[model samples]
Structure formats: structure tokens, C-alpha cells
Target: MGNEANARQLDHHPMHGVLKMSEFINALQVGEHHQQQTIQAYTEYRFAYRICASQLRPVALLQITYVLEAISSATRPTIILQNRPDVASLFTIDPQTGVVRTVESNLEPGSTHELLVIASDQGLPQPLESTAFLSVTVEKSNELRPQFDIVWLTDNGTPQIYENLTIGYVLARISVRDAKYDSELSMSGCESICMKQTDSSNVYLLIVCGVFDRELKNSYNLLFLLSSDDKVILEHPVHLEILDVNDNPPRFEHSLIRVTFNRSADQFDVPRIVATDADHEGNARIRYSILDTNVFSIEPDTGILRLQKEFDCSAGEVRFRVVAEDGGKPPLMSIVDVIADVIESNAWPPVFTKPLYEVSVKEDAEPGTCLLKYLVSAGLHWINLYPFDPYLDN
Candidate 1:
């Protein structure tokens, strides 16, 4: 095929499509190269006529098979793909052509395979070989699913998150596996929470996106999904409890209270003071106390007020402040003003100054005879009254 006689005969009598064939040969002689090639994981690739071919010639009419070989030698070059021993079994190349394919099914995405393609020609003295560097990047496949590990927020074996946390506060950490470079993570069922993935290591952070109130809602159910190419790959469900915070103070039913106390009685019982707190658990427990203990006392648990000390019947009024405090950690409190009107009543009966009235004429005194005088007192002053001997001890 390299003889001068055959070359002249082909030039005089050109075959059909010979001009296109000449252009292909010229392009091969010059050179063409692909900087890099990318393919999806577990997919096949073919190099075909892109092998080390320098020229081609049609030998005969009966056999139209073209003999393609390197211009440097008559024998065809052997193509070999070189990879690291660790990943050598993952890829293979045909010795005849440069067709490369993955033999292993489990090829990770975002992995770059650096391979050395050697084309060696069968020369007489020393074989000529040329090495071409090939970079093949495995792209992510939609069929692959994602895996993840989550660090849950919990208290006493119960999953919970503290309320009143600031926005962007991290609730949990998640480490992701088998995820692509373009994979996305999202959360549903909770508008107050969101997920964010880190730039490195594919780690995700679950954070607070809105406000949380334990009194309004105590628990939440959350769903998280991992997607790639707009397709869902994994789903996770989380059950969480919202921890309580002392945000509500005790509220009094009445800001100002009025009561009437009768000094004629030994003690006065006040009406129950009502107060409420809108917090949960221990934060809602309320205790009552009075600022002035000289005349007023209150129950620590029941908020029952009582007049414990004696006061002048002529005293117009008594004013005091009552405090209602909750049992929270830092404790919240509220106050109410109380006014008591003291009055003396005439409904009480007379009392004797001495238990035994032993006047001289008491035993033989008649029913109308005055045995004793000035025996009882009323209010803050003493009053004189006629008394009769009802009984005498022998």
C-alpha cells in the first residue's frame, strides 16, 4: 500500500467519497485531543475509531475493509488503560481500541479517576510508546439514595428542644453519606425549623427558624427529606418536645381589692385572692404573701388572707399590698392592693370583769338588788353595767 505505483494509480482513479477520506486522514495526522471526559457512575463509554489511528487505506474492491494503523509503523498499537491498584478493577480498556468501561457497579459520584493511556507500536529495534493522560469524573446518578446519621436533641431520654431560642440556633447535627454534590436537604411539618448543609463533609445542621411557645404547643412532628435532581432519595421523621420557659408572670384577678373587717369579732377571715399564671409545670405554681404582717397574713399555698392581729375599733381603714409569686427558677411575681374597713358592732353581749362576784350581799341579794357595777366594757373604753350573781361555789 506504500508503493509509488499504487499511490499514482489511486490519484488518477479516485474512488467514491475519497475526498472525505483524505480530509479525515489529514485531521488524524495533525492531532486532536479532549481535555477531559465525564460520565455517570455505572455507565459505559466507547472510543471507537478515536483510537491511535494515523492513516487508512482501501486495499481491494472485493475486500473493502480499510487497514488503519499508525503512520510510524505497519503494526497496530496496543492500547492500555492504567489506574491505581486500589481502583484498578473498577475500569477496563480494550487493547485494540481505547474504549473504556466500568466493570464495577458501585462507583461513587464526585470521584475523579486519573488514568494513563499508553499506545505502544510494534517497531523492529525498540517499541515506540506514547502516553496520554485522561481525567474521567464520575457524575452523580439519580438512582442512588442518600444515607445519614443524626444527633438528636433530648432530655432524660426524651427528645426535646428548649423554647425561646434565638433564630439560627442549632438543634441537632447530621452527617450525611452517599450524597451527591448537588444534593439538597429540606424539612417539613415544622415551619419553625429548617435544615442547612455545610460546604464541606456534607454535614447538615437543624436550626430554629421561627418562634416556639411551649404553652401554645408542646410537641412537634418533623419530616426531613434528602433530594437529588429534584428526586427524593431519603426521608427521616423526628418527634420532639418543646421545653418550658418562664415567660409568663402571675396575673391577679383584681388590681385593687376591698374588704370589711368587724373589730367586734376575735379574728376576721378575708375572701380568697385569685391569681393565675400561663406557664407550664412548676412555672405555673403560685404562692401568696402580704407586705404588711402587722394585721394581715396570707396562706403560702392557698392565697387565703386573714386578719391575725388586734386593731382599734375606731381605726378607719387598713391598706396593704399582697404579692403573688410563681415557683419558676427565676420566679415571676405580681402585686395587688388591699383595703380593709374596720368597724365595731353592737351585737356582742356583756362580759363580767371577775369570774366569781363575791359581794357581801350577793348571796342574799334580791332579784332587783344591784350586786355589782362597772363589770363589763365595750369597744376601746370601759362601760358601767348592772350585773347579777348567777351562781356561787360553796
Candidate 2:
């Protein structure tokens, strides 16, 4: 009994390496011309499998022998995978061959899976078995596509400024999540905006890198790229919307305007000057006026010039300045020259300033040689004088 006390528990065997086994015992007697003693024999097992490559992509399969170590039993053993019925649903095992395989392709990246593997032998009365724990991990694939956030803003955000945004404006901040690789990102096919990353993070900043102009271009589209060895690993598309700013002043089509005036009418079209503004909304609204309104005025909405007072027939030419301004925060303005051309009418006869005049000419007083002439004309009439031998008036 002393020597038998050191014996191990009895083990059973199951045919085909089934995971359940029956118990059995073998006993040897120790004697010195004395009674017989029973010695018990036990079975032991060793599994040599430690999975080295279980990181697999989606829809991948792994062999069972690669992870299931061999089982040993004194009476020929059988091996099987043992797990809860529900847990068993995750995989299938060949009870005869001791092979295991996955049942689904829904593995997640960077996640681990575990299974219970058991081995048994065919023995009488009951069965003896040994168990092992196995683990596997799924990895991400290199063929996965990149993704980005979506935006649908027809109108620009608050402070929708299309021109001249401050140099350090914070346009956007984007955060990324990827477990396959720690790749750096770059921007391509962009003219106005740029991107930069902070130290030790996947977050980046979309910044205003260059100047903006609403007239030339108000928006941009950028391609965000991730790569290694100059080869593209992933790409995402982003769009930007620019709002119009009130920076450019209104301008007239012509810098100089000419107006013809008649004493009868005090109205004139300074060619109805045409002006344009580049800013958006109210900033692009333009107003017009004659700088000096004493003699001339212009319609604020329409650039029509008008003479405020009546002019006489002898009115002379005059020079006036016309101004155009836009309604911006700081307001912008321009000016042009408006010339008033006066055309006199022939409605009255000429009047002499002095009625009487004395002639201070050299009077020879000779017959037919005396001369006294005045530059005077009859009303709508003309005559040619005749001279005789002694002169008509001698």
C-alpha cells in the first residue's frame, strides 16, 4: 500500500482520439514470501502546439494540426475540441481526425479568439482526458479602402468671408483611426489650403496657406493622401467652400463723362455711367453722386447726371467730379470727371457798347480821295457805293 500510495490517478482511452475517456488500473504486487499487492498504471499526455501564426485576414482559414498538439494515451487515444454548445457554433472540429476549422469569416482586426481543445482515450468503465487552451488573433488587411467625413453646405459657415482670411485661421481639424500602419499623410492637388499634423498624433489641421480672391476663385478641392516609399496607401477627397468678401471698390466703365446742355432743359444723361462691384451681398451695392451738388446732381441708384438749375444762353463750359461708392464695412469709393459742355443759341442781335465814335485817321481832304468809313451794316441789307469825278459828296 505504501508503494501504491505514490501511484497516479487511472486514465481511460477512447477510440479515434475522442475527447472522452474510460478509467482503468494496473497493479503490481511486492512480496517477500508474502501476500500479493496491486500496482496501478496511469496514462499521461503532452500537447506540443503553441500557435505562431494566427493573424489572418478576412475570409481566411487556419489548419487545426498547426495549433492542436498531439495526444497520447496508454490504450490509443482520441482527440476532440470541447467548448460550450453555443461557443462550439463559432467553429467545427473533425471528431475523427482531430482537425479544427472556422465557421465564419467575420473576424475583426486586432482582436483575439480562444478555443478549448480536449483529448481522450478508449478505456473501460469510463474515459480519461486532457485539455488545452488555444488562442488566435486577427489582423487588418492591406487592401482595405480609406474613408472620410461628408459635408453638405451650399452656404459658407459663419463669417463667410471669401477673400483675405486671416493668416492663422483654423479651417478644420481632422482625426484618423487606423491600426494596420503608422503612415504619414500629405496633401496633393491643392492651391489655396494646406494640411499639417501635430507631434505624435493622427489628428491634422486644415489651414489657409495662401491668399483668397472671390473674383478669381472662391473655393477649392483637396486630395488627402497617405503613403510609404512614394507609393499611395490611401486617399480621401475633401471640399472647401469660400464666401465672398467686400474688399474691392466699385469701378466705372469710363473715367471721363461728357454732357451736352441746352438752356431749355436741366436734365442730362452722363451716358448713364455703368459701375461694378466685386464684393458679395450689400457690399456689392453701389451708389452714385456728383461731388458738388450746387449746380449738378446724380441719381444715387442710377448714375444719371442732371443739371439742378437753369442755365442762360451764355453759359460756359464747366468741370464736375462724379463719385461712386460701395456699401462695405469700411466702404470703398472711386471718382470720375464729368464735363458740362454749354452750346449757346443765336436768338438776339448784337448790340454796340458805344453809339458814338470819332475817327482819328489821316484826312487828305482831296476830291475823290477823302475817306470816312464806319463798320456798320443795314438790317438784313447790303449796298455798293458809286463815286463820281468830284466825289459824290464833294
Candidate 3:
């Protein structure tokens, strides 16, 4: 009102219609003075994010992307998905776009992952940070098959199983990885051989149903079938190589061996002894040894008994045993009785018909009378002589 009164007073005095005084008065208004205020747009915050876990598969170029969506806010607020140590390995988030993605393809089905999502507005000094909860459910998928570690396979691609194990021994610890929560193992005809499985783990222990003989069967081919609740996953083949154990002992060709040599003849070797073992390869290799080597020594490789030194007829008989040993974890042994005899020498002693002989003449008849005779003893001698004695004494 004061501005209007002043404008009217100035119009009557000077510059009335000369400088467009009506337009100037129209431009001025008399009222309470106020300061201009700026209005900021408001945005409502959201908290929960529910993602279906079943949608994710291992088929991804880099990573399987999941949308981490939020509501639009005033001043173009930026949304971010936060990471936690507990589920850090499972997933990652984009700060600006709010897109959630997986870090690996090994996510378990039917598992829940928790994360924190923050929504902030474009405030000057500090942005208004809002916290929200993010949850993801891993749905079941049949994309991946169970696998066995390369440690289970040998150079020949066969699994190893030790022999001479107790009734129940763990051959291997096989774990089957799957993408479904209801995956199960079908082990048919396993119990017949005493092969059993642990309740909590996929590991199976080899059972010694009966005596294990490498000579009989060295390995067994095992087929395991894996099936999900919906369908059969795969059939795994494992060849178990059963290692050998020293069990069989060596055996001889004869229980008692008789070896004889004539003392009159030159030195000669006894026949080669033959021994055998049920074991295979190195375990079957038998080494020969004699208990008494004084008069007789045996060749280990050939088992031939050679005369080490001379023996006289006085040594009538020499008896010993030859042992055969096989190469095994614990060597097997056997013995064969050896009887060695020496025949008498070729030379013979003299044998006389009488030591003393009494020869009587016919009452002093002829001067030369035939009386007793002396002879050279037994075996064919080079020279033979028989002499007659002329003794008359009784």
C-alpha cells in the first residue's frame, strides 16, 4: 500500500505519461516481502529382493546376470548391492546399475544367499543411504554331472585297491557333486560283495568278503549309477586294481632228495633241484640254499648242488636240507631233504685163507711135499700169487 501511494504521488508531480508512468506503477506491488524457496522431489525406498535360484545355469559367457531392481527416486538416486563375507563367494553386485551376478558356476541348488542393498539420493555433503535386504534362492538344475577326482585314477586309468585288507577297508572316498537337492546314488549288488557306503558322504569302502588272491583276480570293474530325483544323471565306471600280497609259500619237487656219488669216481655235481611257488612274477622267483654247505654247495639261481670238497668212504653218509625261498613281502620258504652218500674206494685189502697152517708129511716120506697154500685177497688184482708152505708143526 505504501508503494502504491508513493507511485500515485510521483505520477501527479512529474513524468506523468511522459515516461510511461502507468507501466512503472503496474510493475511495482505493495505487499509483505518474502524469500524464494527451492522444492526437492521425494522418493519412497524399497527393501526386499527375491530371486529364483533355479534360473541360473553354468552356461554363461562371463557370469549369469540377475536383475537387482529398485524404485525410481528424486534427484536421480543411485542404487548399489552390497557384498558380505558369508555369501561373498556366491555373488557380486553392480553399484550403479544394481545388477546382481554369480561369481562361480558351483552354486548349490535350494540354497539361500543373503546380501545387503543400499539406495542413496544425490544429497550435497552426504547422500542419504538406505539399507535393504536381498535374498536369492538357488533353483534345481540338471546341467552338471558328477565327477571323480584325477587322484582316483592311476597311470593305467585304473583305481588302486590294496590286498590283504581287513573285512572292511576304505578303498576310496568318492564324492558326487550335483546341482539338485534330491540327488541320490544307486548302488545295486554292492552289498553282495560287502561294499558299503557312508550315510553322510559319498565315499565307499572296499570290503574283504573272502580271501583276496592276486593270482585269482587282480582287479574288479565297478559301475556306479547316479540319478537325480527327476532323472538318471550318469553311469560311472571305475576299474579297481587289487594289489598283491605275500601269501603262498614255496614248494619243492620232491619231499626227500637222495644224491649219491662213488668215492672211487671223480668229483661231480648233484642234479638241479626244482622248486615252485604259487606267487606271480618276482614273488615266484625262488632262491636255493642248503643247510649244510661243507661237502655240498648249491647254486641259488639254478639250484644245482656242486661238490665243494672231497669226501672219503669213511663219511658213509651226509644228510642236509635244501630250502627254496620266494621273493614276496614276507618271503615264503620250503625244505627238501638231501641225502648224500659216498661209495667205498676201488682198492681192496688182502684176504688170506688161513693165518696159520699146519701141514704134516706122510711119516717122513718125500722131501718135497705139498702142504698149505697162501693167496692174495679179493677184487681182481694186477698180479696173482699163491705160495705153498711146508710146515709140519701142529
TM-score of each: 0.46, 0.44, 0.42
Candidate ranking (TM-score, best to worst):
1, 2, 3
The candidate scoring highest on TM-score is 1
**Best of the candidates, lDDT:** 1
Please list the residue runs of candidate 3 whose C-alpha ends up more than 4 Å from where it truly belongs after superposition.
1-143, 148-158, 179-193, 201-210, 227-233, 259-270, 311-318, 340-394
Tens digits of lDDT, candidate 1, 3-66: 1101100111121211111110101121132111211112121111111111221111110111
Q: What TM-score does candidate 1 get on C-alpha atoms?
A: 0.46
Q: Relative to the true structure, how large is the alpha-carbon lDDT of every model? A: 0.59, 0.51, 0.51
Q: After superposition, how far is residue 19 of candidate 3 from its true place, in Å?
A: 99
Worst 10 residues of 3 by lDDT: 5-14
Could you give candidate 2's per-residue lDDT for residues 206-283 as a string of tens digits?
A: 677778887786544455666656675555443345676778899877888777765434334244666888777789
RMSD, every candidate, angstroms: 34.2, 38.2, 40.0
Q: What does candidate 3's lDDT look like per residue over 118-152, in tens digits? A: 55555333444544455555444343435533234
- Specify the poorest-scoring 10-residue window by lDDT in model 2: 5-14
